[model samples]
Target: MQFRLVKIAETSKKKQTFIFLAAILLALFTTGLFIMFLGHDPVKVYLSLVNGAFGSRYRIEQTLIKAIPLIITSLGIAIAFRMKFWNIGAEGQITMGAFCASYLALNYSYLPRPVLLSLMLLGGFIGGSIWGIIPAFFKAKWGTNETIVTLMMNYVALKWIIYLQYGPWKDPAALGFPKIPNFAENAILPKFLGLHIGWVIALFLVISVHIFMNYSKKGFEIAVIGESVNTARYAGIEIFKTIVLAMFLSGGICGLVGMIQASGVNLTLSKDITGGVGYTAIITAWLGALKPHWIVLVSILFAALVQGSSYIQTAFGISAASAQLLEAIILFFVLGSDFFAKYRLVIDWKGLSRKKENKL
Candidate 1:
């Protein structure tokens, strides 16, 4: 007998939805089994997760706060991936954005609040755009491997922030402690109902991106280029320009997340400002199918996981790693199920026999 995997001509949206939901339910079931082995009730653990993420008004707000950065970063990643650009340097871009924005916050203490905030945002945008465009430029000009370049840039940006925290940018008034000084009030983002304005901005960008991608000529060009460079060239789509532009937007949005973190949440630039959101955004983007609206939903769910998992550790005595393990298991099932959605295995005993007969 022989088995062959054949691609499906077209998967219905309803089937795709069913498959993904099944993956999620299966992951939860698997995690429940593990919890049973650990002597804890799975239902209780799940309730704890829900309570941790949204039981209280305060918890809901906190979850939304975490979701803000994830939403922004994931949207940025979605933009790049739509163009088939693997921009792995979002972490670096975030770090650099925070680092650059911090310079204005730390140095220009005399500027008006509005101007300082604007300048800091611009700095963050410029910093992230530069980092993003570098790899794009090289890829466009020489066909350099963008993945490697972007990934390496992340370490470079990371080390730069670490150096700032411990070296020249270190706070002098901290009594010999190694840390960057916090931003001035003028540099900080304003809050609304316990959440920063970054959330508002993130939502605005989300809608804007959705409209831009779904209803613009430029978006069509990007889609064409992503599908095939040769086809894009045949259509006169300025391939190099589109690649660079897509990357710039991608990196710039990630940088905006960094600025928001520094100015709104952390109130300073630090090595930990990103909090792994850059990497998480990649997953969110993929899980969301690179759609802005879908990305928001995925980011919120992930944010809940992060917020709730910490509660699971404290409330249920589960290890912190368990949450991460849960995430991995869910991702595994979802990714694996995508294969079955796209293809089906067919067994062909007659074909196997014919092959064997010919060989004999």
Candidate 2:
């Protein structure tokens, strides 16, 4: 029995190593094909992509700026995903958070700058959590499908943002533009060492989340619930409480992205305030195996892909459409490779069978 257990453990470790290696090779090869398809020398394109992302301080800073929001949103997604919850509505939740933050900032611009900014951040957090909890409530009480509800909520959030920007919040100074007025200067999040405040905060949050997910009793319960809901129930874990709490935390974090973009970068709310960070974050969290630290790495890699492709367009006189196409191609290869990495196919080589089966 001891030997069997040891063999099983060894086999598991071997499979993990093989999958990691395979994913890397597959991503590279598939990206190579994309370069060839674009009629550019794969080597040149690849080098340019590398240089665009990490060849200098300016590039690295930009990459970090992009990574900050991605990491935050992905962290939220990782939580939901680990619990087998499908929250396609992060986009909407983010939008709501931004809208709420913007609202508070605009109204309380008279307050001291630091206090005003604090309120805005709190507004964003509460807004996001509220949006997230809506589905969680229904799911806990009625057993509704969260996936469908979340997806629909995204549309609702989009339209709601549109309604406000166009109808009530429209920047009158912009002459009919569909956006809110710029946030009060005092309400803005301060930049730190030329890096976004969001970056600093996100870094802290990532570490916190890592510790939370891997160490805490609540995290253990979440894991238990994820592995087997029935088993968790039998073990006395409260399913309804876990579901609501997890989803609320997930959505709340996602919403903060909206607040970051609105106050830190855009300084105004728009229909696209979330900048599609919601969807991209899903990819980031999944690619990183739902771990906080790895999610940061994956988010950085994705940032590089976008940053490099944009530069490729600018330098080579390539059209924006083509640059985007190549970016999509590379991402597809990278993401799809992960799927195969975790799974394997066994072939019927030599038509072999076990002795017991052959005898039968």
Candidate 3:
């Protein structure tokens, strides 16, 4: 017998949900075994994870803080993915955004707080937009592979930030250490109810994106292009314009994450300002099915997982590598389920018989 994979043209919502639920249960059970092997009670370790993520107001706040950048970045990714644009340069876009915003913050420290902060946001959007446009322009004009170009741009952006931190932008006050100067108080984001206003911005973008993707004319054009470039052209959609515009919006939103992280979380520009959120957001965007509201839920869950795993390292004496391994196992199982939801494995007896006949 031979095995073949068959795509499911349509799966009921109920079936899809069941597959994902089963995947989660299986992931938990598998992780439980891992925990048991490590000499810890699985149930207790699981409880600790929940407690660490949301047992108290402080813990919940920490999870939300982690989710803020994730939510925004995933939203940006979703926009590009919706247009079937593989924008892998969120890292570069984010870094460039922070770098641009930092330039204004460091130079215009004398400006009023409101004005400087607003300009920083605009600068960040512009910086990221430009980075995103580079790949989109090439793809539209010369049929370049966006995936490779975007991936390469990430390193370019990283090198630029490293140069700034160690070279011209280095703070002389650091006493020979390579560090960028901290943003002035005027450049920093204000907090409301113990959380920086980034959470509010995240929520706003989620709603705005939902509307734009589902209701706007430009969004329809992007969707058409994603479905088929030929169809888009036949439908009179401006393929080049739409591609560039969609990417501009995608990269601009990602840029906002950089500004929020630099101004609200890190309080300064650094080589590590992104913390790999740009890459992580891709998983969230896909898992969320490129939906804005779903992205919020996925980002929060991912944030909880990270926060809980970190907590377990300290609370249960679990090593960092083990905690990360647990996260990887869960993600593996969950992502695998998506494959099964869309396709099924079948025994290809006819093909096996045909092969035997040929041999005979």
TM-score of each: 0.94, 0.88, 0.91
Query: Which residue pairs does candidate 1 place in steric collision?
Result: none
* lDDT digits (tens) for residues 280-344 of candidate 1: 88888888999999999989998998899888999988987786788778888889889979999
Off by over 4 Å in 3: 1-7, 321-328, 344-360
Measured on C-alpha atoms, candidate 1 has an lDDT of 0.90
Instruction: Compose the digit string of candidate 2's lDDT tens values, residues 265-351.
Output: 888889988777887787778778899988998899888877787787787755545534554554565566554544444455434
Candidate 2 lands at a TM-score of: 0.88
RMSD of each: 2.3, 4.5, 2.8
Please identify which of the two predictions, 1 or 2, would achieve the higher TM-score against the true structure.
1
State the lDDT of candidate 3 residue by residue for 253-297, as single tens digits: 999889999999999999999988888888889878899988999
Number of the candidate with higher lDDT, 2 or 3? 3
Counted clashes in each candidate structure? 0, 0, 0
Flag the better candidate by lDDT, 1 or 2: 1
| Model 2 local distance difference test score | 0.81
